[model samples]
Every structure is written in structure tokens, then in C-alpha cells.
Target chain A: MQTGSLEHISDNNGPIIEVQDLVKKFGSFVANDHLNFTVSRGEIFGFLGANGAGKTTAMRILCGLSSPTSGNATIAGFNVYTQTEKIKRNIGYMSQKFSLYDDLTVWENFRFYGGIYGLKTEKIRERTEELLGRLGLQGEKNKILKEIPLGWKQKLAFSVAVIHQPKIVFLDEPTGGVDPITRRQFWEMIHETAKEGITVFVTTHYMDEAEYCDRVSIMVDGKIVALDTPLKLKETYRAASMEDVFLKLARAK
Target chain B: MLLPGSGSATLEGYDVVKDFRKIRDILGYMPGKFSLYQDLTVEENLRFFAGIFKTTPEANYDLVKEIYSQIEPFKTRRAGKLSGGMKQKLALSCALIHKPEVLILDEPTTGVDAVSRKEFWDMLDRLKRKGITILVSTPYMDEAMRCDRVALIQAGKIMDINTPEGIIKNFSSRLWSVRTNDTYELLLDLRRFKATRSAFLFGQHIHLTLVDNAGSEPEIRKFLEDCGHQSVEIEETRPTIEDCFMDLMKG
Candidate 1:
């Protein structure tokens, strides 16, 4: 397993994600308008926007799930347009609704996801044990996922997302409707994962979660209107919190 | 909807069991999930709900004027075609169309963007000023502070109930906000630090509570510096509702 400081990761200096003039249009409607940004190797990049501000469209394009109408982009040093398969192999994804199976046991879910990622059966077993041990869920490995608490299920889903040690992971509203304490725990896990050199690109409606990001980009009407550290963004907008900053930017459009 | 339960509750002096019909008439509920007929148009859904409550949309237009006016332009649009914020506004309008004396909203702001969430709460404030009693249940702890009183629930049990300020004031822990250059490393180190009682990351800093008889702030700072963390900053801070809830859950 690759476990070390971010510096130990190969290609530690260059940004893992790079996009230039990315645009995705749905017939007459422009979902992503000239989006351009770069995410560093191990940075926690928070992609925030209103419901129709084009976050999901851009994320889908980056995840190789869809094609952009016009743009240049790359993920993990592979061209998004030409090398989509390589991009898919290098990135992991977990959305709020479709990351795990409720009827599957803890071990089954891990094995299933690992298999999809092309891990060998023996390797899947080893990784499952290690992950379950780290999460203190060894006794519950055989338990069905539906019986687990929402918080633990979310954490386990995240663990399974990174089971193959992808270069980047995309989280779409991963903490929606979770209780307060569990939300913090899930973030701690995110930080731990980022510390292990996996770039985290997450989208969320929670503004406080925006503060946890190394940098945040707020999309307003399919445009990247603001991009900076939480403190810098707060100062730039002269706002007290990220929520206020978001309100000011989103309301402006 | 009846189940074997051991609880007694009332609304407007009507017992939940014996006067369910009366209680049902006077209560407006917007469940957490969007429950409006998806296949119905915006105006049709509103009219359908209004008809069920023995009212007409025109009869109570004043009550829902603020929210309904926002979506009235899209009246012919399907309920499923509206955006999240618009759907919520329509849902709130349907809930208030009957002019019920009491309104119960279940996590109305969940999954909503910050701007829409603020607008929804502002609309609630407007309703409250108009002589309506409002009860809202939300998982967002920050929303708890907006309420007059909040009940912290855990594992299907109510852990504590009080005004937001009162709950924070009663928090019996010496909380501190600790920051360092590497927050992730700082969290790992703090968890292993012998004097640490509890530590969890909150944005850029970790909300920490030291064990009783632990060393002072400077000593802890020194300890962290010795552990190779630079730019360490520690300051005494009061607990928010979330902090209080976590502490109560532990007890």
C-alpha cells in the first residue's frame, strides 16, 4: 500500500487537475461556461454553487462521465477528452445517493467495489480487513449495511471509494442529512485521506464545510466568480463567514 | 399510521389519539421529503392540496402571497421540473394555504443551498410574526440556533432541550480552538496527546477539550511545537450548539 507524506507521492509538485476554457452546453443552455481551474496534488478543493449553477455538469465532465462541448482539460496528467479511460482509472467517485448497497454486508460492499476497480480477490480481502480494522468495524463486517447507522455507512462508503488508492476522489454532498458529530468525524476521515496524498474534490451546500477546504471555488450561473482560500475569500468579499460570502455572490447573480 | 407507542401528545388542546381528526384539520405539515404530486403542475398541486384542506388558493391567497408569487410565473410547469428552491417554496405554500394555526416543517432546509436556506428561514420568521406557532425539525445544528428552543436528539431519544443560548451556557467543558500549519497532523497529534480529553476538527481549527488537571495553554503549545507543528495557536472559546450536542451525546 502507498502510505506516506504527500511529498512521497509521485508527481508531488504539479497540479493533478487542469482545465482551460471548459464549456458544456445542453442545446441552447450553457451548463458550464468557460470554466478554468487547477487542483493541486493533495489539496481539498471545495466546489460550491447554487442548485443550477453548473457544478454537477462540470463535475460530470471532469469525472469522464460526460463530454464537454468545448474545452481543454486533463486529470492526473491524462487528457480528459482523449484519455477518458485513464482518467476513470485514476479517479474515484462517491455520490450521496449511489455509493453503496443497502442489502450488502460490510465485507461484501468492500469486495464488490474493489472488484469493480479491478483489484485481485486476495488483495480485496486484505484491504477489507485493514479498512475494517482502521474503522473499528471488524465485528460488523458480516452485518448488513442497512442495519448500520447513517454516519458509519457514509464513512464506510468513503473507505470503499478509495479502496483502490485512486489519485483523486469526488464527493457529491457526501454529508447531507448527517448528524453534527458524525459530520465532523467524516471530515476528519477526509483530512486523513488527503494527508495520504489523495486529492479530494468535493461539492457541498454546507458553508462550514467550505471553510474546511484548502481552497474554494464558487460557481455563479455557470461561471467561476470567486476562487480563494476561505479566509481570503471572506476578506475579498468583506464577509464574516463562507455562508455570507456565498449569499453575496449567489444573490448577485 | 398507528403504532404501538408509549407517548402522549396534543396540539391546540386536542389529544393526538382521541382528536386526531381535529388535530389533523388545524395542523399544516411539510414533510422533510418533497411529497407534492410530481406529475401535477405547480398550480394543480397547490389547488389539489388546497381542495383537500377544504380551502381555495384564492380564498387564502394573502397567507401564501409571499412564497407563491415567486413561483406563480411557473404555475404551468410540472412540480418535478422546478428547481430545489422553487419546489421548497411551493411546498411551503401548500402547507400554509389552509391558514393552520400551527405549522410543522420537517428539515425543510435540508439539501438546500445557503441562499435558499436563508430565504426559507426568513419566510418562517414572517409566519411567526403573523400569530402562527412554528415547529421545525432540522439536522443542521446551526439551524438550531435560529429556533427559540431546540431539542438535541440522539439514537431516537431526546438528549437535551433548551433555548440555544441556554444550552451553550450550560455546556460544562473548557473548550478551546487550536490551529496549526498542518491541521490534519495537528488532529492526529492532539488525539495522541496524553492531556487531551477530546479533539475534533472544526473548519481551520480543532475544537479541543483538555482533560482535567491537564497543563495550561502555553504548555500545550510547547508540547505541540515540540511535536514539529509550527504556527500553533490556541485560544479559549465557548461551545456552539454542535459542541454542546457532542458533549451531551458522550454523557
Candidate 2:
């Protein structure tokens, strides 16, 4: 329970993400066990845990992509279970795996994803053009996604994930295998997105990236063992960096 | 021990190209990126690896037993079908199938999850306890701390090699962490500052170096204030491996 809030809780308008005693199970095996926390609007909340620490399970439940065995959660003011479709419309999803269709051209991928989000034809075209220009992919707009470099493709996947301008976004290890340089740039993009008033919930194994978060929750097994701002966690653990803070918590019990 | 497109290298006091078989006999290598045959089961892969070292699996069963036991439950399952962690254990078992004294792992935990990544390192520690020389490389700087010593590399060039503590201690710069309402703009402002030596993005703060100016802190504070940054705070900070790596890369 060594902790500080992601932000000083002064607004009291309710968290954009609220999970209360959340639980998920595969028969007798518990994936997420009575997890409780809230993510503020436009905040970069880093969800961290070991591979099987229930980070993914909780995120899946939050994204309305899956159901929990019990407990309650709400995202963007919508219930995760009863208001999934409504929740889905408020948040974008991106993962390490490029979500763009490899066989489709860059424009096609953007157009298709933009269409799914109910963007008007004119809006989709405008966003696609803007996205292409922003990514410096104007020359590669017609090229199939498979033809682009992995770095560029990852950026496109992220852009398309947020193409419809959701109120919040969930990034599951978005730059998992990217090099240091590209990873930094990707985070800058995240900052830009947050600047635009979109909350970002990111789960990552890279500790350096975890430092970029406003606050981080490090889960162990099926429970959240440590939660705080990266600097605070480091101080609490008497560690120099987030990686050590993570290692300290991960090895604590 | 091997570098691409180079002349024959020496390993364990033997020429890699000239003493191929001799070198192979005493070296244990787990490639950075690897795949086990989808059609081969656990035992089958071990048998194949044993053959590569010109030995029977039974001869070195004891050496691989510890790691193999973890994956033994899925012995009949295809190697390709194992979970990432299990697959890594299996790969390690295969590499150790011949009881080579020297173990070389290239990013063995690259894609493994956090828990399994720790487990893998624990296993390496056990191997080290048994007098094995373990050589490992990982992109994660944090993992570098677990080692007895480390070398910093950037763009195929070696920056420095020292114990993790040594590298941090040797970072010769006045590093500071600057936090403000807008970190992105803070970085841009610092980067544009004349006295700024190097500026790196570190979580919520910018890790910066000053160009030996007496009023550097106040000057930086003034610059951020001019940029209209709110709640700005700047303080000297200890450098992490990532910070040092960024600094080293600039050189």
C-alpha cells in the first residue's frame, strides 16, 4: 500500500476508468483478483506486471473485449458488462501486433478503420490525408501495409487505432520490440494524443517507457502489489529507476 | 563470440573457423532469435541437439534435467506450441544438452514476460553457481544490472565496458531532472537552450546536462518560465543506465 495518487485528487469528477474489486477466473484459476483503482482523464496510466500477472486480463475486461467472472468496472462512464458497445465507442485499442491489414494499402487500412468508427466519408478522407501527412507517409499512402517498414507500420497501426478520435486509448505494449529511437518518438506521439485530451492506458514490459507514465500500477500474480508515480515508487523502493522499482516489487513476495 | 561478415574469430582460445568442431564441442549457444521444429516434441528436439554435439541425450541428461523438468509436462507437445516461457526453457535445455562449459545467450529473454524473464535470469545464476561462464546480451538496460559487468553498445560500436555501477559512476556530466506541466515543450526548450549539453526524455522529467555554466539551473528555470511552463521544478538527479546510454550515444 506504499503509494501516492497518479495525480492529486482535487477535481473529484470521478475517474475516467473505475474498477472495483474486479475479478476474472478460468475455472479455479484466478487471473485478476479483487483489483481496485481509478484512472484519471487525460492521464497516462502505466499498467505493469509479469506476463501472467493479470495485467492483460484486467485490460481486456476494461476494453470491453472480454468479460470478468465477477466484480464491476466502468470505462469512460459506461459499465464494462452492460454498456460494452458504448464503452467501445469511447476508447481506441492498439497492441504490439500491428492491427492494420497487411494486404491493404495504408489509405485503405485507415479508411476501413475510420469507417468502422462511424466517421463520415468526408471526415475519413480528411483524417486519412492528415494522418498520412503527419506520419510522412504521403509518398507511401498507396503502398500495401506489408511493404512498409515495421517501424512505420507500428506508427500507422497506432494512428489508425485512434483515427476516430476516441476519448481514451488502451495501448498494450505498443512499442514492445521497437528500438530506442523509435520508441522515444512513439511516446512523443502518446504525449501529443494526451495533450489532445485523450487518456492513455498503456501496459508495457519496458521499464524505461513505464517511467514516461504519470502513474504506474505493478501487478504481481493476480493482484496489484505496487501503485504510484514512477518517481514515488523509486523513492519508496529506494531504487534509482522504475526497472529497479519493478524488480524490487516483483521479488518482494 | 561470433560477429557477422568478419574473419574467423577465436573462442575459448581456438580459432572459430579453423577449429570448428573443437569450438563447437565446448560452446553452448542460444541464438537471439530461434524456433524449434513444430513437428518435433521435447525429447525429439533434445535428441537432435545431442546429435549435433556428437553425443546421446542420455549422456547429458543430468545437465539438462533441471530445465527439461519444467517443460517435461508437455514433453509430447510440439516445441513450437509451447508458451513463450516454456519454449525458452526448452531452448535452454537443448543448448545445454551437451554440458558445454561456456554458455552464450543472445537476448534469450527478448519476448518473454516479466515473471519468466526473472525466472530465466535465476536459472542463469544457478548455472553460474555451477562454475559456468554465462555471456548474455539484452536490449533491456535493467537486465544489465543483474550482470557482474556490462558493456554499452550503440550502432555496432562499443561505448564502454564496466560493472553496472562503474558505468554510472563514470558518467561525467551534471545531470538534472526537470519536470513541468508540458514535458514535451520543456524538452524542446531545453534542446534549444545554448547551455544545454544533452537533453533526454526520462519519464515525466527531462534528464539534461549543462555546458558548465555557473547559473545553469537558474538559466534553465528562466527559460521554462519564459516558455510559459507551469509548476516547473528542476533538480540534480542520479543517472540511470538508460540515461548514461543516451549520454554515451551522443559521444
Candidate 3:
């Protein structure tokens, strides 16, 4: 019922991502249909769905990895179609599995990501040292990626993703099988990044994890059926918890 | 699929599929990926899924509206552009939005913030009151307490299934949580002790599994001190669900 359009919506600032009447089709399958939503700057948005729900397809469009069959979308004020290169430059991404080289050391991973972002060598070195020290990786800088524990690897992956300090960062499930303690530590890093005015977009299946997001969307069968804060969703569903609400919604479908 | 060789294999007290679905329905399930949309924004994502079960965001708009303010800030963000917590909320929103007869979550809190982790389980408590069958799988032993019933699962097998308290109650052995000046040295010394069966480190505390015939705590502490372990502290503690799980797996 809160159908406030993105342009007029005021909260974290202007809309960083605006999708209007978005549609995506693959042969006979409608991957996405009549999608519309807005993401404000510096907000941590949550994307959720069951498998084969077209979540990845929508992400590809926003990241400029694929074109939409219909509708309009803009990221960081640039069109996802016409200004894809610009969008790419302003946003960083980390896949669910991670986006780092196992063969490279922590410092090398930082340097590589910094280099790709076009940071100067001196700047890269300075930033790399700062990151390594902040993450308590100064001694582990030269350690092979494979040798580090999973929690440490997750931390390192986050460090590399933000090496260039992009305006927005997209993460797909960033935490899957890691221990609970490590996952908590990783989220601390995410909070730090968001504090710096960097928008975060992430997709995951953990309902409890959604309570931490600024807002969340539930996707089923290639469409988004609900979008709200965890508390709001709970209250609306008349369910005591997000999980129950999820089950209720999932079964209703 | 891997059943214990020692058990009498029978289903429904009869056929596997005949009773599996019926029994499974008494439990809820939330897979690592509940299978949602990736490309759609938070709003569309909810709507699409809502439509699938013959429901609309409009039908449940009031309930959705209650959580709306929390997600309003990021409502327009694409599903792909959200964070772990955000995605978790979305996925849960999809799962609970329809209200199932049973709720099942597979490692739902595996990767999330401490605050979010707490918040998520709190939601589950509310749902439990509604009398929905809840079956959840998690690797975290601490979360065991939150469930009405827990089934410690490993490698697709159920190690133990019982109420949280019941599981802990069944932890047959007495546990000692000890810390020493030379923890590693103490561990080595403890391992060789005739009364000790297992000695391993869990964070800062060294947990020792004692033999059935082990001596009293005071005597054990004295023995440890005599072995050159300084400032030894020992507590007779109840076994955790994890301990039971390990015991089950060992069997």
C-alpha cells in the first residue's frame, strides 16, 4: 500500500537503482514481469527468493551482465543499458563463493583489485597496507589464500571487494557454510562499508539474516511478492517471526 | 539416503514415500536457497512469489505493511543488490508470507549478523505460537535451544532428534571445562591421565571427557596440579547438544 515511487521517495537520498515496469523473458519463460522498485543511496538492500525464481537474472540486468526484454532500470543514476560501463565502474561485486584468487596472497589480491579499479600504484600500496592492518592481516599478507581459515578468507574477500571504494557493492550469499562467529565478523565489515555511504545489495536464503538489512524483498516464481523491513513484514503477516511468515507466504504460493 | 546399517529399515512402518511426505509435512523446511528470484527487486520479488500461491501483496498488504517501514528504505533495490541480512528478510518474507502448515528452515542463520540472528529466531518463536510445525536444520549448537525440537543432522543423516533440553539431558557423560596456565601442555598431560577419555580445546576452555570411573573433581584437580598445571579450575558441567551429536556420530 506504500506505493511511493522512487523519484519522490525520500530517505537515504536519491534512488540509486530504479526499475520501472521491468520484464525479462527467456524464450517462452517469463523470468521477470512488470517489476518496479527503487534503491536509495547508502542502503543495504536484501533480495530473496527460492531457486529458479529469476533473482540472478534481475541481478544480471542491474549489473549489465544481460539486457532486459522490457522496462527501464538505472543504477547509480546511470542507465543499466546505455551507461553499463559507467555502472560497472561505480559498483563492486562479490559472488556467493567469493571473488578472489586462491593462488594469490592477501596483499596480491588487494593489489589486483585496486589495479583493476585504476588506483595509482602508490595509492594501492597505501590502501592495501591500511586494509591488511585493519583486518589484522598484516602478518598474513603473504600467506597463500588456501592456507587461511574460512572466516579469515571471508574477511579478506570483503577487503578486496572494497579496495577501490566503489559507490555500490553487490554480494551474492557472501556467507554460506562459514561458522557463526565468522559470519558475525563478516557482517561487521559490511556495516563499516555501509557507514561510508556505500550502498550494499545482497541476496541470501537465510531469513534471520534479513533482520539486519535496511529492507528486504521476497521473490517466488520469478516475481517479488513482498518488500518491507523484517519487522514490518512480520507485523503484516500476523506471524510471530520472519520464518513463519516466510512459510505462510511460501505455502500460499 | 544413508541409513544406519544397524537399524531396522522401514518407513511409514511400511513404504518410504507413503509416509515420508505425510511425516515431512509435520515439519517445516527452509533450504539454503529457498528458491527465489534473483533479478527482481524486493517489491517485485515478493509480489511474484505471492502470486504463485494464489495470493497477492494486496491480500496481505496489512501484514506486509507492518514490516514495510523496515524494508521501505531498500524496497526498490533489486534482489541482487541487497546484503546478507536484507536477502535473509526477503527470503523469509517469501516463506512466511504465504503461511505454511509446517515451517522448515535449512541453516537459515548460517551467515548473518548477531543482531539479525537473534531477531530471526525471535520471529520463529512467534510462528511457533501459531501452531505451525517447525523443522529447522542448523550447525550452530547455540540455536538448538531456540527450537521446540531439534534433529542434529550431519551428512544427510539425523544424529539425534529430541527437544533441546531433552537432547542436553541425554548427554550421558559429565563434562569438565578447565583452563590452565599452559593450556596446551595441560591438554597433553590430561590426555595421558588414566581417567581422561577425550581432551580437546573449544575456544579458551579445554573440555575434557572423563572415563566412566574417573575420580571426584577435587581429586582430578589435585592430580592436574600435581602434574605441574598451574591455577587449574575445573567445573562439573552439563553436556551440550554438540557433545551429544559427537557421541552419536561416533557410534
Candidate 3, what DockQ? Answer: 0.05
Q: Which regions of candidate 1 fall more than 4 Å away from where they truly are?
A: A1-13, B2-4
Q: What is the TM-score of chain A in candidate 3?
A: 0.92
Candidate 2, residue B141: how far the Cα is off, in Å: 2.1
Query: Could you give the C-alpha RMSD of every candidate to the true structure, in order shown?
Result: 2.7, 4.4, 15.0
Candidate 1 lDDT (Cα, 0 to 1): 0.88
Q: Give each model's whole-structure lDDT.
A: 0.88, 0.82, 0.72
Instruction: List, residue by residue over A1-253, the lDDT tens digit for candidate 2.
Output: 0022334322366789989999999899899999999888778889998766788789889989899888889898999989999999888999876468999999899889999999998999898888777777789989998888777888898899889999789999888766555677788788778767788999888887888887899999899998888877888999998878887888777
Superposed on the true interface residues, model 3 gives a C-alpha RMSD in angstroms of 15.4
Ranking by TM-score: 1, 2, 3
Instruction: Give the DockQ of candidate 2.
Output: 0.29
Candidate 1 residue lDDT tens string, B145-241: 8899988888788988899999999987789898886777888899988999888877778889988836689988988999998878899998988
> Which window of 10 residues has the lowest lDDT sum in candidate 1 chain A?
A1-10
TM-score of chain B of 1: 0.97
Ranking by lDDT: 1, 2, 3
The candidate, 1 or 2, that scores higher on TM-score is: 1
lDDT value, candidate 3, whole model: 0.72
Task: Give lDDT tens digits, candidate 3, residues B192-249.
Answer: 8888877654433466778894678887788888898767888877776656666665
